[model samples]
Target: MLPEAEKLQFLKKTELFSELPETELKSICQIANEVAYPADTTLFEEGDEGDSLYLMVDGEVSIIKAGTEVLFFNEKGYCLGEIALIDNKPRSATVKTVKSTQFLRITRHDFYNAMAREPRIGSGMFRVLNDKIRRDLEIQMSAIRKEVAQEESMRLAAEVQQSLLPNQEISHPYVSSAGYCQPANSVGGDYYDYLSLPDNSIAIFLGDVMGHGYHSAMVAAMTKSCLQTQIPFDASVPEVMKAITRVIEGSRTFIYMTCCYLIIHPDNRFEFANAGHPQMLLYRGNNSEPLELESTFMPVGFARFCESEQYYSTEVEWHSGDLLVLYSDGITEACNPDAEMYGLERFKALISEKRHLSPMKIKTEILSDLRVYQQDESTTDDITLVVAKFL
Candidate 1:
């Protein structure tokens, strides 16, 4: 128990009773009860009826909501529960003692008597409550504005990413081709295109940037720009890869890309190259297992290859009735509700079953099967697939 003079001094330091005269402070202290609480004690839970206002004589307390801290109060002058007392509402947050604490507690009945006799205490409490509410409102508005700005930025980025993709369809006399690209989010790193060359040869390309999102989409666009100008119908696979590698290596941001590029001539000759991308499957009419286009070079941006370094390209005869499929890892790595990956074996088996169908039908069935396997789970990466079949 503090002396009367000491109690009056502490109340003078508190905002709620600071304007009151020493005689009034002393009178109020007579009705206030001194309470001691041990460390880690919960003073009150959020949403409980708040009938008492506590003035801290010594100790610290924190306000928490849903396990997150909202505010903290300490020091002899700090007062809590005043807002609920003034508004006649429940407590807004949980208050717990941080250490062994001593407080001067004034219940609703005692507080009302003090407020009626000493109007200064009531006026001071109203001012304090208004200030607290204003500060909390400001914080909430700032957070809401930040969220809105981020959503708008993503929407614009998705629009720009869609525009970067080539919209032209491929029409070749010897083969029919179709391409598909579906980003998991508004924008992603997956990219694919069918380029009809000046020499009547058709070029097919698909690449995935290291990760998904804004940075990945930017890198994908840069990769497409580099490949479009540097690769020609007769350009060697190694040469095209070197050009793309230089662009990635020169970028200020750390990035890498995996790609598969193929060129097919009207003479039934085809050339294929892969840079750490997923294997391309060639389904022959007679064989159950599809031929794999094994990756022979490192992923772009991994290392700077010297001009003398050799890059390997596979040459194959595009026989009639043969179906070729190019895809990204998004297909095989798609997760199910149970977190099971749609593995390579399942993908191969689907192709074997759907090989006899047209290119478009094969693409559709594979996507449908993937959706069925995934069920309610969301895909984490961009899904892109392209198919070409020799007539």
Candidate 2:
């Protein structure tokens, strides 16, 4: 049994009883029993039904969750287990004695009787519980607000990135071109553009930066600027590639991009260059098989090459209804839920199946098929595809 005077002294120091007069504290002391436990004793395990409260008088105890320490209490007059008693809920965490200790245990029935007689005891504990609940809610609300802000920022960035792309497909008397680009995220690194040359030839360029994100997007934008300003429309395919290579090499940022640039003339002859990019598919009129126009040079920004390092271009002649396909590795490397790649063979078959369609229709069909193949799976990279057909 605990001494009445000692219990009264400890109760006066606790938040729950400090507001009460000596008479009420003495009344509460009647319902509480003195309990003692050895070091390392588990007072209660998590999830156990709780029907009592513990007021620490001496020694230390720890509250643990999932084998990790949540908190520790060693000071006299500290109270615990009151939350569970008030809520009539299971214990939220395991409480173990850190050393041989003594505390006061008040059972649910006696506690309620004491509160009925002294309403101040119930009011004090309820105030503490309310404050704890409010703090937890505030923390949760702050986390939600931060997540919403991040999402909004990413949405805005996505809009800006989309604006940098061509507004629509281009149609000409000698050539009709259509292109599609999608990032694996809100912003990506794949790029495609069509330029009207001065000599009645059309330049179509498609490229992919090494990866996706702000750095890759920045590099893609830099590539666009170099292609538009540093390289001229009349420049030969090799000259165009070299000019882009030189620009990237001079930049302070070390980034590489794979690109395919093609210039189509009125005579149905197109000069094409590839910089360590995927091979271009040239389908002759009324033919199902696509001839691969392979890359003859290395990827740009790979390393500083000597002036003597040679880059070459491929020239192909075609007739009306012939189609040219240029794409990034994203399409070929797209994976299904099973981790199987949508490989080059499947891409070529899709192209062959849709070869008779218009450039815009072909672009639509290929994207539709890609979506089907990647059902419920996230795209692993930025995708870009450009289709140009001789009219």
Candidate 3:
């Protein structure tokens, strides 16, 4: 047992009694009881009525919640369960002794009666709670500010990504094209671009990074840069695919993209190199079922493992008024509340029905139809569509 003087010194160090007058302090020391418990003893449980305040004197205790240890304290003069003196609320967490421990315990009834006689101890508790609340608010406000800053950064990244896309529609005398992309987030991984090539040919490129967000968007940007550099001098289907493959293999992010590259020439002949991408569709002006532009190679990042010869091209014929559909899998994979996906066959039917419309109109109608079809699963993944019509 601590001597009377030593107990007074320890109680004075505690926040609840720190500002008490000497007379009130000695009064509390008289009422306070010394208690001891062995290790592994449970002092109280969550949801039990708060009835007593325990002032730490020695050893340690653990605060637990829902069977998980939340915190532990070993320092002298650190009070535990002090809130019981102020309120009758149930305990918020379980308390157990981690080792043989001693505490100066004060019952809520005793503390309240004592407070009526000497009010300073009561006011000091209010002061301690005020300081605690202010500190907690400061920490929460700092965290909120950090989150808002991160959101703004993503908004800026989305703007930069939007700028990287070509105008939604590109006009050419031989072939006209229109494109649309809906990112699942502020920034996304799907991207597409079309530019005129030699001999009135237009080089079309579409890619989908493995996932969405700033990192995936960065990889898409790098892939686009790789395509821009290669198309200016070469623009051939095989050469462009090689450039895209290099960018994916060299990326520090170690991610992959499903990609499609195609060249449309005045002769009505088109060459496509599919890099593990979903099938591209070509609707003949004849109104027959659309031709599926199947995958000719593995996806870009993974293609690094295979021979360069696997990165090759295939030829397909297109005629006047023929419509081409280049898209990411997000289109066919979108689901509704019922867990039903807007499927491939439905997409092909839409292309076949809308083939006669201008490429821009076809692009709009398809996107609008998808919006209706999504129902609730509208923005699960980035969606991209590029529609080209041979004039």
Best by TM-score: 3
**Clashes in each model (backbone N, CA, C under 3 Å)?**
0, 0, 0
lDDT of 3 by residue, 41-74 (tens): 9999888888898888998998776665656779
Cα lDDT tens digits, model 1, 1-391, are 9888888888888778888888898898898788989988999988999899898999998777655555566767677787788788888878899899999999988888888898888778877777778756754565466567878998999988887766755656788877788888889999987777777888888899888898899888888888778875346666777777888888887788889888898898899789899899998877889999878777877775434335667888888899999999999999998999999999999989988888889989999999999997988999999988987
| Model 3 score (lDDT) | 0.83
- Writing each residue's lDDT as its tens digit, candidate 2 over 79-167 gives 77888887788987789999998999999888888888888887678766776576446545655665677789778878877777888
Candidate 3: regions farther than 4 A off: 1-128, 304-309
Off by over 4 Å in 1: 1-129, 232-235, 304-310
Q: What is the lDDT of candidate 1?
A: 0.83
Give all candidates' CA lDDT scores. Answer: 0.83, 0.82, 0.83
Model 3 has a clash total of 0
